[model samples]
Target: MRLVESRLTLTVSYALLALFAFIALFPIALLVLNSLKPAAQIVQNPLALPETIRWENFTNAWNHARFSTTFLNSFIITGTTIVLVCTTSSLTAYVIARRKIKSWKILTFYLLATTTAPIQLYIFPLYFGFAKLGLINNIFGVALIYTALYSPFAVMLLRTYFIAVPKELEEAAIVDGATHWQVFWRVMLPIVSPGILTVALIIGLNSWNEFLIAITFLQKQENVTAVIAFFLLSGQYSSDWGEIMAAALIIVIPVVALFVFMQKRFIEGMAGGSVKG
Candidate 1:
């Protein structure tokens, strides 16, 4: 009886997990399915498999969205933001973790508060300022905005990783006549690299998918990011649902591929930073 009950419990657990997995994947499956169908077919039956696969949808999406240019813009913004955030946040996290400052708690609180605060509060002001500075359609300018918006969270997350490093390592490096910069650059950064990779992946994903700030600051056609380009594919009166789905799929592919590739390091970083010593 006991053995039977255990088998039953295990079966039920697997069943529930499979159900949740299906639920999570269903929308993505639908998106891929619809991308190969005609717009009229999708309207008639989204669940039905395409009678004739439409490979041209992908080509049409790429051309109509001008992904060639917009993808380059996205890469520029994402790369710049990642570099700036990682460089600054790692330094800041190291200082906060290693230094014995009384106001560190206050600074941490401020970062936490800012992370929760809505970007909507500052959007108008930021737009006006960027316009005055002639940065409205500048890729680098948008990157700077992403850096500021993302840095607080990056600093807070990296602080935990820095705190997890053994203090004796820093002391030993210092005793060997290493300067503070050398200690931080040569010793601490390498140990905390997984955390940095994790941060980069996160910031890259956010920067790529971010629409509001991208659309607002990059008004010029040539400067728009891929997300903005994808958004522009929809018409006020009508939209090609197949092409739209194809565009959406194209946008998601890079992000998904990247996450799959870096998932191991990302997991390690998250686990490493979970507990502070």
Candidate 2:
């Protein structure tokens, strides 16, 4: 009787999960299918399979959208942001966690407290400041802003992980004549490999898909994918829904792929293992 109940519960849970998955994927699948159909055919039968494939949709979307340049700009912005956030946050976290200094603790608290209530409405001043500095439409300028914006949370993440890291490992290295820099580089970083990767993935995804900052900071017609895609999809050619949906699908794929690849690292990073002194 217990075995039958367990089997029934497992089957019901899987059925619910499968139903949810189908609901989520059905729309995406419909989009991809319709993207291959002619507009006439799409309107005639939106749910029907393509009578003939229209591979030109992707080609048109790619060239017209300047997807290569968009991808390049996004990569540069995201890559730079990831590097800065990881380096600065890790250093900040290490200091806050390892030093045990009062000032450092106070600073950590101040930084972490920002996460409780963010100043979302105060960015207009910064926007005007960036425009005056001639930083608008520049990828590097956007990346710099993103790095600063994302680093506080990153510091909190790394600080928590660093607090859990045993100091004895670094201490032993210090006793054997390792300098603080050497200890940090050789001992601490290796042990926090998963956490570092998690932060990189998080910051990278955030920067990649960022809509408001990209739209606001980048004004050049050719500088931002998020801006370009938004305008393209929102234009009067609302009749050309296939291309719009295809573009959306393309842009979403990379971030989804990154998250899936790093989900394990993220989970392990936040599992909160003990820190020894």
Candidate 3:
């Protein structure tokens, strides 16, 4: 009876997981399928396989979306935000974790609060300030906003990894005549690198996909991110759904490829960080 029940449970669990996987992948499969079909074909039947593969959709998307310029803009913004968040958050996390300051609790509360607060509350004020400073449509300015928006969560997550590191490493580094900066740079950072990489991947994906802030701040066609460019591909009266899907696929490919490549490290980082602190 026990053996039979165990097998039944396993079968049910596998069935549920398969169902969930299908649910998750269904939309993506549809997107890829529709992307190859003409707008007329898609309107007729989105589920139908294309009778003829139209490779031109991809080319048309690339040209119409101005991906040549927008892709570079996205890379610039994502890279800048990643570097700023990792450097600053790692330092802050290290200090908060190792120093045992009385005010650390207050700082933690502030970070938690910031993460929970909606960006909508500050968007108007931020836009006004950036306008006054002539930062609208500025690539670096958008990167700065991304950095500020992501840093709180990065610091909070990284703090756990920093805390998990053994204190003896810091003590030994200091005994060997290492400066505080040297200790953090040479010892702590190396140990918590997985956490940093995880933060970078998450921030990069968010920054790449972010449309609201990008559209609001980057008004110029030259300065818009890839996502914003993809959005602009839709016409007011009528949209070519095939071209739109192709544009969507183009924008998604890089980030999806990156996540797949770094998935192991990302998993390790999440697990390592969550195990303690």
Candidate 4:
């Protein structure tokens, strides 16, 4: 009787997991399928497979969205944000983890508070200051904004990895005549690389998909990121749903592929960070 009950529970667990997977994948499958259909066909029956694949939808989307420009803009913004977040957050995390100063605890608390603070609290002043400084519509300026908004979370995530590193290693490095910079650069950084990569991926995704700040700060047609460019393709009046879907796929495919390839690293870093601090 015990063996039978265990088997039944296992079967039910598998069934539930399968159901959830289907639920998650069903919309993505539809999006991909409908992207190949014409707007008329989608209107008629969104679930029906296209009789003829509309290869032109992608081309039309590319032309309409001016992807050539927006893709570069997104790449610049995402790359800059990643570099800034990783460098700044890793250093901050290390200092906080090691308690290098009497105020380290207070600094950590401040960072935690920033994470909970709402964007609305600061966006106006930030925007006004940026406007006064003529930083609007500038890719680097937007990247700075992303860096400020996302770095606290990165610091929190990376702090765990720093804490998990054995203090003896730093001591040994110092004993070997390594300077503080050298010890951090050559020893601590290499050990916590996974955590840094995890932070990079998360920051990149957030910067790429971020709509509110991107749209607000980047107003010029030439400066808009891919997300904002795609937003223009959609409107309340009428929209080319097929082209919209194609544009979405274009923007999403790269991110999805990257996550799929680095899924193991992402999972490991997240799990390892949580395991300790």
Q: What's the number of clashes in each of the models? A: 0, 0, 0, 0
> Would you give me the overall lDDT of model 1?
0.88
Any runs in candidate 4 off by more than 4 Å, and if so which? 1-5, 236-238, 268-277
Q: In candidate 4, how many Å is residue 60 off?
A: 0.7
Candidate 2, overall lDDT? 0.78
Q: Rank the candidates by TM-score, best first.
A: 4, 3, 1, 2
lDDT of 4 by residue, 1-277 (tens): 3546677898998899999999999999888998898999999999998999999989998888889999999999999999999999999999999998889989989988998899899999999999999999999999999999999989988988899999999999999999999999999999999889888988898899999999899998789999899887765312878888988889989989988999987676556535755
Q: Rank by lDDT, descending? A: 4, 1, 3, 2
lDDT at 191, model 3: 95
- Give candidate 1 misplaced runs (Cα > 4 Å): 1-5, 100-102, 235-238, 267-277
- The TM-score leader among the candidates is 4
For candidate 2, write residues 158-260 as lDDT tens digits. Answer: 8877888887888899999999899888889988877888888777877888877788888776887554554654474345666666666678777667667
Backbone clashes in model 1: 0
TM-score of each: 0.91, 0.87, 0.91, 0.93
TM-score of 1: 0.91
Model 1: per-residue Cα lDDT over 170-265, one tens digit each? 999999999989999999999999889889988888898898899899988789999998888865312989989999999998788877888886
Clashing pairs in 2: none
